[model samples]
Target: MKKGLLLIYLVLCQVYVYAQEDAWVYLTDKDNTGFSISNPPQFLTQQAIDRKNSQGIAIDNRDLPVNETYISQLKNQAGITVMAKSKWFNAVHVRGIQEDIDALATLEFVDYIDFANSSLNRSASNSNRQDKFEIEESLIDFEYGGTQNQVEMINLDNLHLSDYTGNEIIIAVLDAGFPNVNTMSSFQRLRNNNDLLGGYDFVDRTDNVYEFAGSNHGTKVLSVMAGFVQDQYVGTAPDASYYLFRTEDVGSENPVEESYWVEAAERADSLGVHIINSSLGYTVYDNPNYSYTPSQMNGQVAFISKGATIASEKGILVVNSAGNSGNNSWQIVGAPADASKVFSIGGVDASGAYSSFSSQGSATQSTLKPDVVARASSTFVIDQFDVIVNNNGTSFSSPIMAGAMACLKQALPSVSNEQLKQFTRMSASQYTTPDFMMGYGIPDMQMALNLALSVQEETFGELKIFPNPVKNELHIQLPSDTDTTLMIYDVLGKLVLKKSFNSTYQKINTSSMISGMYILRIESSSGSKTFKLIKS
Candidate 1:
């Protein structure tokens, strides 16, 4: 009996060794055919092209699709499972035996083979269940219910009141799965208006995301953004369009999910998604050997981090959860959340206090993370049954902030993705003294929008107003010499002053004006310019 047991043990060890041979092959270059930057329609949607043109972003080789010939030939192989493909890295992820991985290196198009899995030793215990810290659930009558606190906490209600409901803005949500979203009443408006674009279940290689048997985390996460049920609960961006993507397999954690996320991001870019909300983060894995160390939390280390950064560079706003590991032994933000360009959101309570389970960061490489905070404690989200459930975690916070960003985008469509990030950070309450746990602290959507408006006015309008809080005199500078008609009005739209001039520089006297705020509109041959002015 002892001899038979030893034989079985040896065989198991051999199988484990073979499984460890899975790798990702990076190709040096792609075969140039059928794709061109000048002709973007072949691989990019018109919306995507328009976004690039609006931002003055140049389409280059990175926008090109991966060589289909190479992918087709690779798929024909018997022993390999083509898990994911990345256009940004020009690589293909595969699961195979040692012999097959070794054979891939010899291919002429292959650049080099690298072990995609981390080499760190995994813990003997395979189970590492993450705990979620949530506060009490409070029920209320139909009318924004418990969700009103979250929107008010971030000051996004002001924007909502302004009628900026993220109309015409496209957001792509990448998560585990979105089960029951199609039938949920909260999503009825989305379906009625065709706001819910088609989605895919990448884990199962199917386009039926709603029918897939998976976690309901995605449905809840998305509810924080697009769900609406009269006064019971209303998401931040109720009018925004969405594309749901299932990139995670909750049963296990491995490098393959990172590849799946990259593939989804690439698709989002091609479809002209303006924003991507990812409530998923990675760290310890089922296979200890595939887990990432804290030191590897640098923005450039993880594959998902790199992918998120590339997505941001492509003019797409990428928002990620900072992970719910703050109270655990591994108390730090996860990959993709550590990415510099990715807006990592932390969780706080309605009273502006940090949640105990919100991940802290300044990565091991010492870069501040959890770029901003949002109310997640006892946050209201729609369940698969279309019921509001109070929950907590950065997962809830991420979508809340993402929805706000969609509104901000709708208000300032010309602001570049990078500039949007800067504006949000600068508008945060703790911008000048950000801490590791909360980074820039909670951001104010109204403040961020105001800042973005200033930037856009300066960039396009080319009109400058000095001494904004003018006591008696106000000056306006136009970009060029043209006939200009200036009109000033009170907040109620009552005209206060009107003047005409043709010089590039002009000044007006307002010594008798009362102390208040007014809107200054300039109509010229170039265009119409509006400015918010204050009087002392």
Candidate 2:
């Protein structure tokens, strides 16, 4: 009887020794590549190349795909199963026993192995994994119906009236399952117009993104940008094209989802997507050992946040939800939202008040977080069942802001993503007095449009505008002698100051002007020039 008990105990020990753990295998190089940066068509689409060219971004080695031979070698290893691969990071996400994973480090192509369990890896850190899809109660004009308040609060309706409704722009939605979006009545217009492009389920490694059994958080998030019902409801960017990507696995909280998200982001970049809306944030995880500490909230620490910053550097306008942990002990924005380059969005109510549940910015980071706020309280969204319902969370607010950004992109195709973010911040209600909760506060889409338009008309050569964000005085210097008429208009298009000068320099008193963005236009016989002026 004692011998039999010993045998059983040995069998249990073997099982425990072989338990699978998630990890990322970093490859040393992409040595065997047939693609060249000069011939970008070999890997990048024409649209993507054009976008990079327009933004003055060069195609580099980072854009190259990972070595498939390396991936195959890792897969052939004993007990190792490759899950997701990222070309941007030159790494592959895998699952295997610790012994098996560690053996991969001996391969010639393998750079190192990062275990998902932070305790196992010395240089690696984990993310805080929260339920980003949690329902919160929370649009745009043109019979916006339940969405009128949300839309008008951000002044997106004015842009809609001006015909800047996101035409010819593409936005990718990265989230959980989007069940029923392919068959729902609320998405009928998108289907009929062929605005619903293709999508992929990275979590399931499938092409069908609308058939998953996970949470329907993606369905409602997309509705805020693409759903439409005549005379009843209209999404913020109803005319924008879309690409759905399911990167999150709602069934469990794991670091592999971050790899999946980066993989999806790479696909979006390859597909020439102009904007990416990720209504998700990571904070705490199911495994306590993989949970991130508050200090890791710095934009560069988390893997997902690093990927988000790379996506932005690639010229994609990456928008993320700030998180819904404001009322909880974890009262700070999560990964990707904390990423410096990402345009993080926060939540607010109908009265333009901060939502109690909107995540706050970290006191450690120098950059302002929750870059701007939008209506998230009792915001209306179309569920998987085609029913209009009120939901709450930054998930809804992020999409709302994303749709507005699409319209702005359509209106100012020449503006870079960084400039777009700056213009949006300058147009916010609290640009001069931003806070942790609201950041720059609610954005005025019309004002942002005006700011972009004014900057686009800068034609005067050698013209210099100084002391911008000026306190009490503004200075201007011209190239040559010419009778120039100067006029300053508020963001509302209301004339605030007018003067005519022929000298090479001019100064204007701006002490009495309210702190905000204004357009300074100068006209002469040569041509008209416009400058974006800020009074602080």
Candidate 3:
């Protein structure tokens, strides 16, 4: 009797373990093309759930179970269990194994799957972005162009970095490693500011990956976000904080690299990575057969893309590069790039013309892609020695925007990631009429900031501009008592006019300016202010 009872207990324990694997916390891959926050895909089978879990290596917490009807419907599918159903949305976390991944990919309702991976601190980045204008004329960086654009750097000089920095808005940059950052002069301020949160090393499965500098990619990405510079390559948001995860190893673009990214995303979420900017893309790899076909662009085919979307739904922001495909035939968005929910950035020249290298759209039946464009060609960045290097790619664009979003999030810490994305689309150059070419168009940081502030209060400021459509002679007033500076910019973010209006009351004239939308910025001894002006 004792032997029989023991056997029964052992059998029951095995069943429980299998049951645990059968259920998982379901999350949408907001960055995945066919799946994610902005575009969600349907769950397929149990096999699909297991596959995604194997990729993510993270738990989807199966505290809840799927409804009876839903379970009955999914009975035919392999590796699938209705772990739980969301009362609000179709999104639900499920469980299964690798076979489920294949099954779900074939299902019409399935979008993508993220499996569990154990690697950590792995990140990817959009490395090449241009802060300098890309017009046909000689491009001037923020420094030299300040005079021509009429933007007074001095006006924005006093804005305290921390006042606009948010602790919760952290991004984990996955790349080779950053050994020189602590000693590098360009990144010293970031280190001193303690801008870096703790990180992990997935390659060795050890914590000692930070000791040596390996790939320049991660370092460059960090420089674009946190590198402190006044005249040199100023990151999109210099004061913003970040955490660096070393997931990529030197020299090899391993097939397992995707697994590493999954690990990084999990760690990033645990450590509260507000955003993820990975410049890497996948199509070809060490395993040629493992390479993806255009048909696999559905989002579930690639492990990393699946994980990218999973991260986004967890409230972590994810940005990916559309790929440098302008020069290639497979010019469409890559794996994770094909994932729907994530923001895939494209590259534009200093002339504002789209670059030939920027990857195209999500390939699985033409979905929205390159959600936005930023300066990527011949863009300036800090290299190994803090020297400015003009490189190009959607890789750099992602980080610059990530940094800017960080500042925006800092300005309004309460704004959910969903709302931020919505604002970005609505305030974009092509919000209402989005195209596959540019998801919404480039984002204007100033306008975005102004709008975010406006939503928070009855009025962001008591300031106003008159002669609303004045072709010239623009007028302005503010309620601040401190000394002030005035600046006017064109719709292109180029400063066309500027003056000092330190007095509490002052009249300004822009009668000589051309007709178009303009921005009037007010800068008190305190930071700065922005206004939307129209010249007709």
Ranked candidates, highest TM-score first: 2, 1, 3
**What is the TM-score (0 to 1) of candidate 3?**
0.58
Name the runs in model 1 displaced over 4 angstroms. Answer: 1-20, 118-144, 363-366, 455-536
Instruction: Put down candidate 3 lDDT per residue, 1-536, tens digits, no spaces.
Output: 99999999999886654333222223332222232221112322333233234334333431112333433545567657543333222233455554563455564454444333211112122223221112122233345432111011111221224355444456788766766666778877777777766677776666655576455667766776777665554565665567677766655544456666766766666554678888777765432323566566666657677777777766677887777766565667776777877777777766556787787775363457877777677665565655656667777777766766676677666676766765565556665566656667776655555555444322236755564545546555566766778888887889888788555556666777764456777777556767666544
> Residue 534 of model 2: what lDDT?
69
Candidate 1 C-alpha error for residue 92, in Å: 0.5
How would you encode candidate 1's per-residue C-alpha lDDT over 1-536 as one tens digit per residue? 99999999999996775485446788878666578777899999999999888888888888888897887777777677788899888989888775677677777888977665544112122337454323344443445356788998888999999999999999999998898999989999989999999888888899999964657889989999999887677899999999999999887667889999999999999999999999988876656656677767888778899999899889899999998888877778888989888899998988999988899995374468889999878788877877777777789999999999999999888777777777788778887688888989999888778766653323236778777556799878878888989898998999989999988888899887876567888888778867776655
Q: Given candidate 3, what's the lDDT at residue 72?
A: 53
Find the 10 residues in a row with the least total lDDT in model 3.
147-156
Q: What TM-score would every model get versus the actual structure? A: 0.82, 0.89, 0.58
| Runs in model 2 lying further than 4 Å from the true structure | 1-19, 123-129, 136-144, 456-475, 479-514, 517-532
Estimate the Cα RMSD of every predicted model relative to the unseen true structure.
6.8, 4.4, 15.6
Q: Among all windows of ten consecutive residues in candidate 2, which has the lowest summed lDDT?
A: 135-144
| lDDT by residue for model 2 (449-505), tens | 876665542435887777765679878788887998899999899999998989989
Task: Give candidate 2's error at residue 234 in angstroms.
Answer: 0.7
Q: Is candidate 2 or candidate 3 better by lDDT?
A: 2
Model 1 residue 421 CA deviation in Å? 2.0
For model 3, what is the alpha-carbon lDDT of residue 208? 58
